[model samples]
Target: MADVIKSLNLLETLKESIENNKLSDVKDAVEDLLISRINLAVVGDRGDEKATFINCLLGLGPGDDGSAPSPSPAAPEEVACYLNPKHPDFRLWDLPPVPSTSPFQPEGYMEKVKFPRYNAVFVTFTQTPHPHSVEVFLEARSLQQQTVYFILFTSAKDTEKNLEEKRKASLVALTSHGVSLPKVYLVRPSTLEKLDFPGLLEEMARDLPEIRAHALLLALPTLTPTLITQKKESFKALVWAAASLSGGVSAIPVPFVASMVDSSVGVRILTKAQSSLCLDNESVERLARQRGADPARLKELRTCVLSVEVTKGEVKKRLAAAEKEIATVSSKLVEMAMPRHARSVSRSFAAMLQALNGAIDEMAADAEKIMAAALGKGK
Candidate 1:
């Protein structure tokens, strides 16, 4: 009971340190003594030390379950060791009181079994699980409090059915017994350091800082600072490119912008060299050769531009009208520069590139800006 109290006190101290952002003392306290003594307990039919059977594996423990099913064994359950490596850095202790043997009928074999302060318990079973064993594990989980209960079934048979039944029964027992307990983790034992077993270990690491120490040791690489930096660089490039193409869609006739957007920076730098070529006859022919746009889709693509193609007008008149529309959209593009959200981010580069080819209306806004002084004086 005092151990739990001490653990709570340490936790409160840790919480205070975090809130105050003062952790220098924490680092200095236990820098050298960094070993975690993980405690483990084995129980039920499969956990019997005599019978060396089962698949999933964990931390430092021996190969067999101890009294592994002998070639010619006698009512083997009583003669079994509850835990194989009863004493080790990570102790797998015996669970006392094997049901059939009473301490009064000589000595309850289980009564002598020491219930070690364990980190977790490995509840073993076979292929077609006996419901009795599942019941014992469920009861053990309720009593263990913070300790994690992991189920290990080695028989290469349909074991899922028994596990589901245990789960439903455990849920009911918790309500009836009023025992707030941790969930039983179902594990397929393999190698000790197997990546898949971390979740089980983490569950049992509550009061034991040592268990958590090893976990954090493996976890650091996955949460490196370099990964965070890489993601930021990617997002930055995307935002920058979106800014440029959106600019082109709103600009004057300039194919150079397309090349500008094509430049590759660390991420993807958008192009600034704008190219706008119309597919209406002469300009259309020029663009078709340059951009490889399908001849059929040229007109459809042209409709996205600001000016309509004129077939009958004089060359100068058509150019004059096209230039006027170009300047108007150019001004709008500048206005879009200060927009609340990025404009071109959602659009494809080709779409923005198409917008650049609007025919030049010869009505010169540049000339008007220049001749405004003369007109002002006359008015």
Candidate 2:
């Protein structure tokens, strides 16, 4: 309960900082909430398909083949770690299958890989269920670990009936071994957008709400409207933190210095939000190129509103102007009446909060517009 109160106080401080335009305080607040790492493990027999699916989630293209290792049947069970370049906190582990010819038991295999360390484990298979994979899943359940049984179809063109039949057979296989059927997801590596990809992500988020902001926001593709909305909502929570920090900084007796600090913090928050939403230059350029659209158009659209640098510049300009006005009023009040000076300072804090709120609203709206344009919805 004490920890919860501390967290709430920190969030309140962050929100106040953002509202008061105290940039440095907002940065401190945001840094406090940034997740260090979220561990996800992919356990499967089909190494090639598993690697391909992992790469797809990382948004790597064919040219980036070596980004994830595709282990073959003949190869040893080596664990490969894949981190999202944009959000390094999300770590995906590709765990090799337990060899059929190996003398070691399933429990030994689990211990070798440090299975309990993972927040979520995915047991992937193609066509039929493998006994070794089922053994690993049961062991994971016995350890009280969160696990998902994933079916990756070899053919993207498989009909719904065929997919359902495969799912039933997989369940039967698990039941035959006296193991309960785990949450299952059917996916086609070639057509990830069509299947239970989003559902799988939502399930992970539901199970691990503490790291949901980093887990789902970083791993899930931004091709769908639902994903974009989730990204926005995740960032919105940070906005309050930023605002609280800004407001706290405004209480300082120093005049111009507080405003300067606020400008810098605001820039960092906006930049972080841009990256989190996958609206950075690299992501946008990749999207434009993929859709056969001119990358220059994205730049043009960004200049109008979505660009973080542009937003930062505007925020600094406005804050600077406000600071000058506040300084003049403060000087007059200090000479004539100290009470008036204190009141003026309070008003300035309120004004800064209002301005910051407008800036945040504009940036969020621009982010949405940028996403729509990337999806080919906006001309």
Candidate 3:
């Protein structure tokens, strides 16, 4: 409920800024809400499992460029950061596991990693929950960091019964050590479509701050139907904000000249939406590689007009084509919310909004098709 209210409040604030013609505040909101920075730390040392998990989360293959390096036999001595190639604003930090000590001192370990800098901390383990890792979780709790997670990576051969037993055991250990409430996410890196990986993402979306959660949603690949739906909704908010900015600019009273909308604004909004929805060539290629398929086969599934390269000329063409139909709907909306004198501004805002929304809808449909095809489903 708080998340929904917060999102509405943010949109309301942006609407007010646009109404007041606070261009700077509107721009700042765009940066802060859509393209903000989010740091996520994955702590623990399962070597190949750890690296593979990171790759899956970032939509990378084991050998893809920018994927986390497979650790050697010796544990890594320092923390390493891997930026999401698609979304540079989202960073994943792989922290070295706590050193083997007779009596584990989590304070030294936390200090070494600069823990508080991360928006979410994920402590991973393979078979059983590690005491030292739980200690880190406890320490993070003390610091009032509520976005901590306990992830258990299971092997392919692990049966459902075995997984259930492990979950029970993990909860028992966490509770025994004074954890108020315990939760363990059982994941198989090879098959993210199965298991609790999706649930983990949902939890993160709920647990992280609003802006950070929005970043996470856009940064992730549209692997499941749930994620695709969430991404579409997020893009709607973005389109509304960008369109409002255009409307706000044109609505300002002028001396003698008329205000016109810029075609570049629509171009920028559509371009950002295309990449954020993972419909671009690079994102599609990455998703294909993760599925061990050829990129061209998946690219063929993107039949939407906006799925192609978004260019300014194409945007202008769309704006011109959509204006007549959009003006009718937009005029009615503007009539209800705005005055008679605001009709001119309504046309500009309505055209931009309709064009962007149309593109987003087409791109979202293409994304769904590509995801289904990539997952080996029939069209």
For each candidate, what TM-score against the reference? 0.33, 0.72, 0.88
Error of 2 at 149 (Å): 4.5
Judging by TM-score against the true structure, name the best candidate. Answer: 3
lDDT of 3 by residue, 1-379 (tens): 1234445555666667666666566666566545647898888874888888887778778777788877633346678888888678788888887666668788888888999999998888887777788888898889889899998989889999999999999899999887988999998876676799888877887788766787777777676866777777676666666665566554455321122257776776677777767888988887776666779988887887678788888888888887778646745665654334445567666777777778888888898888877787321
Descending-TM-score candidate ranking? 3, 2, 1
- In order, what is each prediction's RMSD in angstroms? 26.4, 7.7, 3.9
- Lowest summed lDDT over 10 consecutive residues: which window, candidate 2? 333-342
Cα error, candidate 3, residue 264 (Å)? 2.8
Q: For candidate 3, what is the lDDT?
A: 0.75
Q: Cα deviation in Å at residue 145, candidate 2?
A: 1.6
Candidate 2 lDDT over 164-194, as tens digits, reads 8887887777788767645557877644655
Number of the candidate with higher lDDT, 1 or 3: 3
The number of clashing residue pairs in each candidate reads: 48, 28, 0
After superposing candidate 3, which stretches have Cα over 4 Å from the reference? Answer: 1-13, 16-23, 33-36, 72-75, 249-261, 330-344, 377-379
- Candidate with the greatest lDDT versus the true structure: 3
